[model samples]
Target: MTQAPGGGTAGRWAKRDASVVWHGFTQMSSYLDDAPVVVERAEGHELIDVDGNRYLDAISSLWVNTVGHRVPELDEALRRQLDLVAHSTMLGNTNRVVVEFAEALASVVPVDRPHVLFASDGAAAVEQALRIAFQLWANRGVEGRTSYLAFGGAYHGDTVGALSVGAGGFGTEVFDPLRFPVLRAPGFDDPSCLDVAAAMVAEHAHELAAVVVEPLVQGAAGMQMAGPEGFCELAEVCRRHEVLLICDEVATGFGRTGTLFASEQCGLRPDLLCLGKGITGGYLPLSAAVAAGHVFDAFLGPDPSPRTLHHGHSYGGNALAAAVALRHLQLLEERRVLANVGVRSAQLARLLSAGVAPLPGVGDIRVKGLMVGIDLDPPGPAMRWGRRVCAAAVRRGVLLRPLGDVVVLMPPLTVTAGEIERIVAVLGQAIAEVTAS
Candidate 1:
């Protein structure tokens, strides 16, 4: 292949990026020095960069591509929809695809009676959920029930309201001044943690609007795995306190936790469920805040009043996204993706525990479905170990993104058994190399 203008393959693209594009969550000034990989195209499980390096895409391209890259069904669905309509305001007008998608979602979304309210992404969905829950309380003329309870290591999203309920102990220190105070309990997975959570909710129930949580697992918080016991206890406490229970299943949804939804594993249903990320098979940005029928009733009022839900995005229910999402669901059902996740997840857990757990400096390897977090011990050496190990794995072909010493694996659900073994083997080698060095 002929190289671009400046020098290497990505020279032209790099120059263009340097002059115009400002990437998110990155320091652009030093970006040119490192020169980010320019992906040319993606096959099923691999990404081909401008330099022709093939990466396994083990992180699922930031944990969104649940199935795989260049999925023909999803791509064709988007293309078909694009040929018809690409953009339209979803404020008053509705799309046939969006309506159908909502119908499909309502059938299996865990909530007893679901009414879908679309949004652009996970954070927006979560914000809408929190707003709806609070608004429902307000509409009922409930006095002082306004606060939200959350777990200590919870990470919902980056938006203002999401930042509010998200615990401040993490890297959110800069946003502390801007965040609203939220009641937090111990990490939900800890033993006897339910009692602590219940006590906190009971104390604040009179002033609590909702208790929002990432059901069974908290993703961004180092891919931490919390079992259903804590979630069930929290749900029971919320039920007793009359506080709304909002479950953020953006990461754990769509069979990531070996179930259709993590709530199913725990047998607990929340008043509101926020979903996104893998909702559209990672093809498009689509999210929804699903509320029960009673919660929806709060928004229905006789007059133009505060009971109505005033929050909605212009791309709230895009026809193309919905079509793609609906197709993604059909693909899931047609392929039995949930059962695949369960099988693959068990295989991965066993491989990690048997092959990688004995490595030096390795603390714990927690696996829930495809979401695996291998936590390393100590901050100094282990942090460097994680970075080096991930870099080595990248060299070996798998793309693993580590979170401050925790190497997380969130591969596509369609990954084959051979790919699973390779992934585990590469990770094992990476761990051994890092620790030995």
Candidate 2:
């Protein structure tokens, strides 16, 4: 065991972390005992802990990482930006890099004349989209368009507005008092969720400002997915009703779903889109709320008047973030990442079907591009199979995380065939060990 600075054994780092830093969605009293990985640094697709242990980051660092960590091109992009500037207010003024990046993004996002409002994270992006949808109706003098329609099993973000639209799981029930109500539709797990949502939209179009959905995959909802055709039908309903459609692609965007945006696969051109997670290749805090030309035009009357949105974030369009984001976009094309996602997604599905599906402890498997969830079956309502299975995988040098009983696998886009095999082998071993014991 290595000796760390403050304590004797480096494992004390978790204890030190528990004493100070409060982690989200973690029980602080059991933080140190839970044996959280004290990550010192990362290389390629592996995270190196303080004790010099390297674990394959099978979850893509909670699905934020896209290409890989410590990427040379991204590092160079950040360094080049640092030579000029770091951050400036995007409030009344704009930065050069912001314009350049936004132009690149606008050219690609699946929206008519997309205009981006940058934010620091996904929650803010979703919140911005919600606010824009609400204000669009108010600005256009449309009455009774105050409520929103969001599907069940949808997890947008943690902010109040985002939570209001979200289906509310993952220990978020305590904050229900703060979450405003929205028209609820069936979750993606339901075969006819999209059709049901469309019906609800048509029935409640009078009071609906927008219908918010997570296009192909409801990521936080245990990677639940629906067919692309359902999304197309729901979008058509939103179009016919003249209710703005908002796609919260904070998890499914930036090639996570076999395309630049999941909306592209679903043939959707939403009025507003929320983007995050992989925007800067997991390098920085960057997200955006994209508005179509029509929605953008709604707020175009009188600059210093009620039409103008009275909201701004201090570090909305930080130059460093924009610089890295621009490079990331270019690299996505240059490296042919999306094509690789297709090939690997097929491989992943095949491998899971052959190796993991028939196990006595396995229940179900879902895959959409590189995003995956393997549900575990425990006899007699056993608890924490997910947590134990993930911990066993970590001990075997592959990092995995779970949502309830669904173990997620989200490797970086650049992951190789051998790495995928290694991940699958380790997960199978982990599951075997846990179920046997």
Candidate 3:
């Protein structure tokens, strides 16, 4: 393989990165050989590496970026917050920006009379939700409702509490000793998953604190998706059983799945909603665990009361993050971003079915709006077909990543039609080349 023009510069950066930067889910020893792209800046939906090579951000920077990189509105929001204050503890006192953002968030989230508890990332949000749900039962003087019900192939987060309820995969099994067990249900791969989950909820309702799910999509499980009706059925089951329903929308929120929240499409009123990723339009790290009014009321008590659910992050409601997130939320509506998502989603479905799905080695293609996964049938274990295909796409100026044998393509919400075409064309060519090899 040939290197780009600034190979020397990229090589130096890669060496420096390998020496000090221990990236999560990466093997540093082979990082240099992998031809890692060291990004220096971003423009619109493209990432410019140190080598001056521009690659289309096919996965929205791992499904976080929404309105695109370097958005002017998001940048100005952060600047405005900086002029007032940057950091303040949410433990005792709350900042004005935080309060305003929370109000704005509450207006849009699917939960009724939602109360926001800020966190720094998706895992923290899930952890907070888990704790809140567990304590909600205890606060209500409900005994024996101590367990949680989660579906298989669920990827909530990596924190101990989050991982406890999450279905273990992706090299997480080694940490089984640290994770607590939950009542596991089948994933969406099985057509009867919802039926099975409903039955589990009925049988375990007496002991289940909450029925946690990813709503309409299980992103980390190779973009596996469930029908809106299926989610509605599960919600109905939870309601019938008198069990709380927690929607882990960390991946599906902020118009990733053609809706502000997947629960909205499913007609679900989750007791708790976990949001992250695009909350700040990828400008900052911020997440929130939104609780319904009833859930919030359960924790209400006098000062220093044991009924208080005590958990918070040092940078929980950072002013800058809140300000940016509030502006991002506004921009989503003002710019009619969800409308674009609908159009782009249709285009993507057409392109994938016509261009990529029939390519050699392509086994299955799963798509829900912009989130996509292409399952590849490798010739053998040594082929590493998914990684090789993504590498080939990168060489063609398209950035992509794979989940084992599943290649994902999740472009920014603001991506243009031409960019989508380029992504699909490159992916198709890459798959063809790798399979023919």
Residue 350 Cα positional deviation in candidate 1, in Å, after optimal superposition: 1.5
TM-score of 3: 0.98
Model 3, span 359-415: residue lDDT tens? 878988988878888899987786788889999998889989998899998899988
Give each model's whole-structure lDDT. 0.84, 0.91, 0.90
Model 1 poorest ten-residue lDDT run: 1-10
lDDT of 2 by residue, 1-437 (tens): 22222223446887778778999988888766657888899999998887787888999998899999999999999999999899988988888999999999999999999999999999999999999999999999999999999999999999999999999988889999999999999998899898889999999999999999999999989999998998888889899999999999999999998999999989999999999889999999999999999999999876578999887688898899999999999999999999999999999999999999988789889999999999998885757999999988887788888999999999998888999899899888889999999
Of 1 and 3, the candidate ahead on TM-score is 3
Clashing pairs in 3: none
Clashing residue pairs in candidate 1 are none
Model 1 residue 35 CA deviation (Å) reads 5.6
Off by over 4 Å in 1: 1-19, 29-35, 378-383
Q: Return the TM-score for each candidate structure.
A: 0.94, 0.97, 0.98
Q: Across residues 71-190, which tens digit of lDDT does each residue of candidate 1 receive?
A: 898899999999988768878788888888999999998897899999988999999999998888889998788889888778888899988888754456898899888888876447
